[model samples]
Target: MPDNEETLVDVRSLHHRLVRINRVLRLAGSGSGLSAGTAAALWSITQHAPLRLSRLAEIESVSTPAISRIVTSLESMGYVERRADPDDARARLLYPTDAGRDVMSTARNARVLRLAEALDRLEPADRDMVERAFEVLSDALVPPEA
Candidate 1:
């Protein structure tokens, strides 16, 4: 294993690279007219439908009012809707509309295509190395329950 200083240096380099990659991916995937926060909230709603706004705020690490604004934007765009929670009439659940799912699908396809184009430039061995490295990092970073 490397010394602490070496590990820190490598980690910093990895962070920089990941940030750049994320920026590229975000641009590629954001063909939708929605802002980043609004797009992200819609995607999350699609993934975890029938969930409370409070839970979504927690998941997104934003305040309730902030998420509420995003959700309002989404609703205006016809991307998301709120339904009375079956368990509690006082609480409402968020669900993505069909239009919302279509937007997300289109965005996801664009991002995948962009990434695939980049990966295609690499040699087969380098591509394999990237895959292995991604797997290792994902396993290390993700919680066991996740």
Candidate 2:
């Protein structure tokens, strides 16, 4: 090793920059109409349709009030609809409307396009290596609960 070699601290600075970049990419996508949290809420409901609000809050690990606000916003935008639960009259079942599915699909496509373009500029071999590394990183990052 060269004398100039330095320790790979994997410091707080790197973590901060990584987080900032992720946020920037999220904001710079087809999600111009909705905030990030709202978009996440939409995605969650899309994945778990006819889901309950309490369950959604638990899955998202957010306060019930926060999820209610997001659901309210989604309802007003016609992105989601709430109906009485068939199993429980006191509870409600939430589902995305056609418009909501359209929005979710658009957002997913935009995010994929942006990421693909960014990786496309790299050499094919390098891209493959990075992709593999990302898979490993993803596996490592998943929490036990996930």
Candidate 3:
């Protein structure tokens, strides 16, 4: 069995490598003309449409003001819109625009293609291991509520 310290080191190394891969994928799909944070916020809106700004901030784990700024950018880009909340007249809910969906779809495809190319360069056994590892990591990281 791996010692705790060795496992921790492996985890840290994996985290750094994943971060670098994510950065590369983000850049590869950056033709959508959105900043990383703004694109992430838009993706969140797409996933949970008609959500309140506070709820979005909570999901993104960012300050309300930070989310507000991201939303402002998305709104200006015609990627998202705010509609008055029916239950609460004082609040507005965010939804992705049709254009936003198209852009996000294209961006996702680009990122997937880029990742696929990288994976194709690996040996067959290594590729299989990477796929299984991702499944394990996903199960470990994402809770049932998430």
Candidate 4:
């Protein structure tokens, strides 16, 4: 087995490569006319709809004001809606609209297609190794419930 130092170096290298890959994918898939922040906000809302603004901010690790602005822009674009929170009359819950889901879906598909094309260029064994590596990493990040 590799030593801890060797594993750390490999992990750091993988992290840097993944970051670059994500940036390229984002640029290639940014046809929805949304900034990265806005797109991420929309995706987050879709995943956890009916979320409070403050909660969304916490989940996204952004300030409430930042989330508020993004929500406002999405609302104005008809991609998201603010509905009254039944539990709190003064509070509003954010939900993604059909348009928002469509936009996110399209953007995700574009990015995946671009990635698929790149992966297709790799040797089958190399591609298989990449796929298995991702599976292992994903399992490590979020292990299945016992």
Candidate 5:
């Protein structure tokens, strides 16, 4: 078994690699023509719709003001819209318009195509190894059955 220090090093390396992969994929998908922040914020809003600005900020790990700016940009693009929060008159909820979903779909397809191109270059054995590794990682990341 690996020592604690070895385990830490492995985990840190994995984190950095994942971050780099995300960065590369973000750059690859240009169909939306959105800044990274705006794209991420829009994707999150779609995943969890009727989201509040505060909640979006929390999810994005950004200050409310910063997220507000991204949302404003999205609004200008006609990708997102703000509506009154019936439960709280003081707050507004964010929803992705039809255009936003279309943008996301285009972006997603571009990123996947990029990844597939890279995967296609791998040797059969190497590709199998990647698939097995992903399965292990996926299982490890999931919570145990209740």
Candidate 6:
């Protein structure tokens, strides 16, 4: 078991990482239709291929109204479309429109470019470690069920 000092240091390091990631995400997501949670929603929609509104709300761990508001915002921006669910006429499914897909593609490219620029000065080994670390972090944040 780690000592108290070691545990505190580890916690502080994790908090710092979270804060930095949040700040970067806020910067990356600003002026875009996709914040971190919304981006996760979009990503899930793509992966699941026409997920329902209630399901999406559950996945995002937000209220139905919150998902509705996000979807409404996306719909207004022409990034997402809601169609009646075939299985359940009472429910609506969400999917990305072509414009929405374009938005995702452009944002992905921007993130690549931004991270690439930041990594330019790093040692190659450090950069590779960062890449691996991102994979681990992504896996932790988005579980298999999620």
Displacement of residue 57 (Cα, Å) in model 6 is 0.4
Error of 2 at 78 (Å): 0.1
Given candidate 6, what's the lDDT at residue 74? 80
Tens-digit lDDT track for model 4 on 22-117? 999998889999999999999999999999999999989999999999999999999999999999999999999999999999999999999999
Better of 2 and 6 by TM-score: 2
Across 1-146, the per-residue lDDT of candidate 3 in tens digits comes to 45799898997898899999999999989999888888899999999998999999999999999999999989998999999999999999999999999999999999999999999999999999999999998897787883
Give the candidate number with the greatest TM-score: 1
lDDT of prediction 1: 0.92
Residue pairs with colliding backbones in model 4 are none
Quote the lDDT for 39 in model 2: 88
> How many angstroms is residue 89 displaced in model 1 relative to the true structure, after the best TM-score fit?
1.2
Expressed as tens digits, the lDDT of each residue in 1-146 for candidate 1 is 45799898998999999999989998999889777788888889999897999999998889999999999989998999999999999999999999999999999999999999999999999999999999999898887883
TM-score on alpha carbons, each prediction: 0.93, 0.85, 0.89, 0.88, 0.82, 0.76
Tell me each candidate's RMSD, in Å, in order: 2.0, 4.6, 2.5, 2.4, 2.6, 3.4
Candidate lDDT (C-alpha), each: 0.92, 0.85, 0.94, 0.95, 0.92, 0.78
Report the C-alpha lDDT of model 5 over 53-143, residue by residue, as the tens digit. 9999999999999999999999999999999999999889999999999999899998998889888999999999998998999898899
List model 6 lDDT by residue over 40-122, tens digit each.
Answer: 77766666758888898888889999988888888888878889989988988888898888777776677666666778989
Pick the lDDT winner. Answer: 4
Candidate 2: lDDT of 126?
96
What shift in Å separates residue 63 of candidate 4 from its native position after superposition?
1.1
Q: Candidates 4 and 6: which is better by lDDT?
A: 4
Which regions in candidate 1 have their CA more than 4 angstroms from the true location?
Answer: 1-3, 144-146
